[model samples]
Target: MRDSFEHVYQLLTCYFVKVRLVDPDFVFDIQTTSCKDKRFTWYFWCFGHPTKTYKLLRPVVMNDETFLKGRYRGSLLTAIAIDPSNHIFPLAFLMKDSKTTESWT
Candidate 1:
């Protein structure tokens, strides 16, 4: 687990690049501290297909967050919408070191 976390930046970069290659409209944002020892702060991503499909889904969007446990503690945030058929469709996701008003913003 520690080993995996150590390579998170590289893995994340590759994952984002691959996603973008498959989806030109894939949207993502990564933020890190500017301190001497840079650290991961938060990450947000939304797939291209979902953005396009949202127009055909219900107007209401639901979102929620959960606390993560284990070596790395954090919050996982997600937003989803219901389709015309009442199927849940994911819209976006976020992972942050902590959950706060500033993080939500």
Candidate 2:
């Protein structure tokens, strides 16, 4: 996992670029600290299709998060909405170093 983190920025850059190519409306944000270590702070992404389709779904949005268990612990936060047909509609997702008030904002 440590090795993977070394290349995480590069990998994510490629991924975000590819996503943009396929979906011009795809949106993403990656935040990093400017400390000596340059640690990754948080990441957020929302696909183009979901953004366009969200208007057709119910207005109510539900959010949930799960703690990650591994060498580098973190939380995976997700936002979702229910469609008129009762199907789960994913709105967005976030990965952060930890679950904190600042992270939620």
Candidate 3:
């Protein structure tokens, strides 16, 4: 799966671009080593509503990480907040090769 990192990176950039196209407020970031290497990291988030909407929601957010049990092992990190309507509002998501304090920070 090492060779697929480039493909995954391309797909994720495309996905984020499409999301931003639909909702310009969405924000995303991509980080990687030098072009000579292919290790990559991605982070994306959307407020889902106006800035005022955030004040209505609780001022609490939760984060979690889980190891992926798939062909290419990795970790999925997610940030979630509870909206005023009591529905889950996913704020951010990240995928990384491993779970570590460095990555989480």
Q: Each model's C-alpha lDDT?
A: 0.82, 0.81, 0.71
Q: lDDT winner between 1 and 2, please give it.
A: 1
Q: Which parts of model 2 have CA positions greater than 4 angstroms off?
A: 1-5, 8-10, 49-51
- Where does the lowest 10-residue lDDT sum fall in candidate 3? 41-50
TM-score of each: 0.82, 0.79, 0.74
Cα displacement (angstroms), candidate 2, residue 76, comes to: 0.9
Best by TM-score: 1
Q: Candidate 3 — which residues are off by over 4 angstroms?
A: 1-6, 47-53, 100-105
What's model 1's TM-score?
0.82
Pairs clashing within candidate 1: none
Instruction: Tell me model 2's lDDT, rounded to 2 decimals.
Output: 0.81
Per-candidate total of colliding backbone pairs: 0, 0, 0
Residue-level lDDT for 99 in candidate 2: 69
lDDT of 3 by residue, 1-105 (tens): 234645765687787888888887877777775688756654555545547556776899899988876555678788888987889988778777666577667
Name the Cα RMSD for model 3: 3.6
